[model samples]
Target chain A: MTAALETFDLCKTFGALKVVDRVSLRLPQGARHALIGPNGAGKTTLVQLLSGVLRADSGRILLAGADITTSSQQRRVKQGLVRTFQVTNLFRGLSVLENVFLAVSERQGASRQMFAAAGRRRDLIERAEAIIEQLGLAGDRHRRISEIAYGQQRLVEIAVALSLDPKVLLLDEPAAGIPSRETSLLLDAVERLPPDIAILMIEHDMHVVRRFAREVSVLVGGRILMTGLPHEVMSSQEVHSVYLGQAGQKRFTAGVPHV
Target chain B: MTARSELLERHSYNPIEALYWLLLIGTFFAFPNYLSIATTVVIMALFALSLDLVLGFAGIVTLGHAAYFGIGAYTAALLASGGWREPIIDAVLAGLASAGLALMIGPALLLLDGLPLIMVTMAVSAILFEAANKASWLTGGDDGLRDFSFLPVFGLFPWSVYGQTSYLYALGWLALLFVLVRRVVSSPFGVALQGIRENRARMRLIGSPVIGHLVRAYTLSAFMAGIAGAVHAQTNKFVSLEVLGIDTSVDVVVMLVLGGIGRLYGALIGAPIYILVKHFAAEWNPYHWMFIIGALLIVAVRFGYGGLLGILGRIEAWFARARGTRKP
Candidate 1:
């Protein structure tokens, strides 16, 4: 079967630095993939190139067998390839429900209606409410984003992404900065997404990587160092020496004793 | 479930809105002698409303909105003097002309943001202003366009010297545009504009055509402002370079900021207060009236981020607390 999202020989350079150098990745439909690396491993840069936030200097990106390397960010989203930012980017002045409703309405093609009141769109509001409830944000749906806690804001960001009904979802550190207790809610929310939607998550937490991602890709120096089943990728010494080094390898072993 | 239902309830008709409309209509009888100034207020309010649509809702900063206004004024003046005496048709043509100009420039102009965007808009207005000035043969130069008479409203109510018909004519347009704009700002399209305003990058991620939406909004806003300009030309039977002046553009922004930026009613609230203050203060000293207006703007900005509406909202919230009622 054709991969849902595939990048072949993708290369991006920032003057003297080659941030993402000839990296190739394939995410099949419904695949649960994790991308992990230490700081400056170009994980975020790779995601940016795929989402069209940044143009790749060289290489091709194929979405469901269609070459979309030159598509604009909005066009990429319409093509079912969507991503969340590393930092929470939301409509801060609007209510949480308004934020999600805007996404849902766009999906429904109702966002172009200028005369009908948004509140009167029961279908859009109902779908938005269902998404909010699914994400455990129903209680705070009516509150403006500025009134919510940072962790709740993070969940709202995911909720906005899910509202797009993406075929290939690129999550950039969804659990970053979220408290451990709140992280469970986020993970549960992610777990509940429709199975046919492919997910590629970039996470730094070993525990989350083990719990969520079935397959793993270890990236170092702007290239994928290894890709295998989670157990094999985590246990590979090449990934350790290049990514975790000595001290990080010891911490990884100590923290995840079973792996 | 109750909370979810309450979300929809917020959009329901409030009794206060009825009272507000009644009060606006009541002003016609309450101050008959001030009808001329009142007509000016109505025109400025429409202009401010147009600015609010783009600046407040879409977060597209512009300092040269007068380009559309002047274009509309000149279009209407030329048509009326050139023997096209149908008042309503002239206004519609004027609006369309302004919208056409906006459609051409909005795509390129809206691509810029912040200081650059402001500068470009100012440049557009400056170019138009200079063009109108040098094209003396067509526009009557500094002497201004004269010798034009608007046909009576529906060929019935004549243009009275007492300004009653003019006030009612401008008020009718204001009322129509106000309802249309209010409906727009409460729609999904309006919400999306707010999304664009608040976070444009995220708006794009959600598949919203950000620049396209902004261009449409700018075009619609120019259409409304064009009507206001046409009304001014029709009522005065004149058009001049001052119609496209930077002061008119800057003044509308001040009016929008003074009343409130994003709120729809801010235009109505800001226009009358500014116009009335200018009317009275200029009477005392025409040269120094700007100082009072400037001082009022500083107070509005320093104290209330939402302008007067924000201040009133705070007061209402305080009252609700004092009465032991939960704040809405």
Candidate 2:
């Protein structure tokens, strides 16, 4: 299978500490991969580098075989690589639908047609509505983003990311702040996405990991400790050592791991 | 109406905006044949509105906009004085000179924010004021430049000091500037600027070159101010250092604040109120009139950051709430 996204020898350093230490990985097409690690394991930093939010001090990122390591965040989005924030970054003052509309408008190039009524664009509105409905956000579209429930806010964040028509969607803890009820809704939306696209997600909850991710990569101290099926990775002893506060002495051990 | 409805309504130009424009043009047009004081009021109102475009819509807080205005006046005076003039040449030169100065200063001003930026911009105006003062041969220095022959538009009617022609000329030019500014604010460029005002980091993440956009906006706004300045100089047949003074710069910002920043018609609404107050102040003890105006300004700012429009919006909301309550 062709690789959908690949990072080659990516390195990033803040002073002497290597936040991402010459890491490299290739994600195949249609793979639902997870990046999981203990705190300060560089998972977020790696995601930032992959999504072109931060420049890799030394490396290249290939999106469908095209180098886009140094491109801007918006350029990467335009090229079908988009990301959601760990914290929701939205136009909070505007309505929920307006947020989605602005993102869609970015694609239609109709943001400049000032005198013409922009809300009248039936096709764009329909597309936005479909995304909202698919995410179970139809009832909240007309309300200001601030008025929405927290779980709904997470859905809207994903909706904004989806608005870019991305092929490779990066979700940075999509379930972070919401209650468990909204978490399931978010996971459902992820599962139901079209199969042709690839998703790379950073998730903290083990339940979400077991439910949504087909493949998992565990990062410990800025390096990928293991990559494989979720069961295989989770059933390992080293994964347990890292999770159980004994990563410093472990070499290689295999069996059922602790939380 | 709720805040959302008020925001939506603000996007549309209400009848009040139309009325302001109508009264402005009508007064200016009728002045030569109707009244002189009305022409003066229209000219100041136009100048104030032009400054408000950058101050309000673009979220650019400036205190040196009058530097461009002064530069425009100087350019017109230099080009048209002593019979060294072509109408188009004078107008274009005035605009170019002012815009050039704005462009030169814009980049340097980028690193500053809030009071620092305001202070730096005020310094820029002061620098221009000194230049105008010291450039005796070119600008006539403290004596001020005089004897400007008004450039004839379309070679049909030359600019005149008499009530009708000058007033009509200023009105026509003001109308054209207003349209041009309206088009700019409604463009994608304007939307991007507004986005920057709302969130700079987000705008950068979305691929807007923040400094580049701001510089372009500042240059365009300065160019418009230049046109206003050229009109002012030609109207009075004189170019004075006061155009570059700190007081004039403060006055432009005051007009914007009073009218409410970022609202185009605020400039129109605010300018007339300011001028009328100033006019009355001059009539009543000019010094004490300033004290009264200062007190009013304190009240305006204390209540809301958006000035008169914010106050008006709050009142409208209160009435709507009252009506809704009564209905149930």
Candidate 3:
């Protein structure tokens, strides 16, 4: 399979801290991948570098085999390399459909329409409504972003990203602020994503990782400690170090009934 | 789809919008003695409306919008002195000149945000103000630009001493620009602007050319402000360095804030309230006019949550609820 998104020895540093040190990854087209790490493992930093939110000090980023090492965030989004924020970063003042419509209309190049009412664009509304329905957010279509629940706000984030019609969707903690009760809905929506789009979900929720990911990587201290099948990566001793072992809980790894 | 359109239409300008204009028009007959002050209110409304595009909607913190206003004023005065006396044509040219100025400096100014943005905007206006002061030959320096008159509007109606033609002339421009600005604020581009104001970073993530959009808004805002300035020059029959002064810049923001920031209707309500009070209060007690204005601002700021329109909205909502309907 061809790699849809790949990074080569990507590096970023802040002051003396090497935040994302020599991270390299590849997500083949339609790959269901997860990047798991302990706190401060640079998972978010790596996503930022890939999405062009932050510049990598060294190495390159590629999307469908073309180098996009230093493209602007907007350019990267236009080129089918879109990302969602770890925190819900939506227009809080806008309604649910308006948030999604902005993305759909931007894709349709109707944002420059200076005279016509934006809501009157049926093509944009239909696409936005369809994506909202896909995410099971149809009931909340009339609500403003601030009026929606936190978990639903997270769903709106994904809906907006989907409206961009990306080839590679980078979800930075899609389930971060979502309640456990609602995460199942998020997972169901994730499962319903178009099969052709490559997804790299950066998650701390191992349940989601186990439930959705076919393959997983463990990251610690700004480096990937291991990458393999979900079960293999989770059962490995290195993953134990990345998760429970770091807080002087190495013994906890062995004390577990089953990894 | 129709439901969404209806929802959007309801969310737009209030139904009571027609009343404000009707009252403004009624002023020509009802308050003929005060038409001059009423006309000033109309001009300032347009100016404040232009500021709303950048400062109110796009959330660009600016301190030098008067640079455009001054440019428009000077453009009209210069054109008039140069024997190009068509007022409407001169105003259009003034608008283009101001927009051209925005094109020159908007890129650099848009790069900086927050405090630096405010400082640079102030500096731009100060620079323009000084240039006018020093260039006596062209701009008349401290003496102000004078010695020019406007041709009869459309070669049909000449300007009158009782400020009759100027009142109607200014009102016509205000209505036309208001409709244009309303359309702009309702369009996709307008929604994008509000998005930029609310969450600029998110806008970039959504694939918007943030700086490019800001530049366009800034330029268009400058164009509108220039038109107001040109109208001011044509109606008042004079131009001064004050048109580009920092006080002029600050006054527009004050007008917007006192009226309601980000509401085009707020500019209309706020400008008239301000100028009318300034006119009548100064006539009553010129020495204590500042105190009167200060007290009005204090009461408005402390008690008026959304300014007058916001209060009007609350009243409308109250009435709607009283009638057991969501809207009236």
Give the candidate number with the greatest TM-score: 1
Clashing pairs in 1: none
Residue B96 lDDT (model 1): 95
lDDT of 3 by residue, B136-223 (tens): 8999999998889999999999999999999999999899988988788788888788778888888888888788889999999999
- Writing each residue's lDDT as its tens digit, candidate 2 over B1-328 gives 0233222233345565677667766675554454455555555656676676666665677788788889888888888876756655676678888889889888879656678888888888998899889989889999999977764776888655565666777777767777767666655455555666765665555444667777777887788778778877877777889999988888877766786777776676677678778778878996688887787688779996678887898898889889999995
**Ten residues in a row with the worst lDDT in model 1 chain B?**
B1-10
What TM-score would you give candidate 1 relative to the actual structure?
A: 0.95
Q: Of the pair 1 and 3, which is ahead by DockQ?
A: 1
Better of 1 and 3 by lDDT: 1
In Å, residue B81's CA in model 3 sits off its true spot by 1.0
Off by over 4 Å in 2: A107-138, A192-194, A246-259, B1-12, B25-37, B82-89, B104-108, B151-162
lDDT of 1 by residue, B272-302 (tens): 8899899899999989999999999999999
TM-score, each model? 0.95, 0.87, 0.93
Off by over 4 Å in 3: A13-21, A241-259, B1-14, B322-328
lDDT of 1 by residue, A147-182 (tens): 898889988988998899899999999989989888
| Candidate 3 per-residue C-alpha lDDT over A98-142 given as tens digits, one digit per residue, 9 for 90 to 100 | 889888878888878878987566778889999999999998887
Q: How are the candidates ranked when ordered by lDDT, highest leading?
A: 1, 3, 2
Higher-ranked by lDDT: 1 or 2: 1
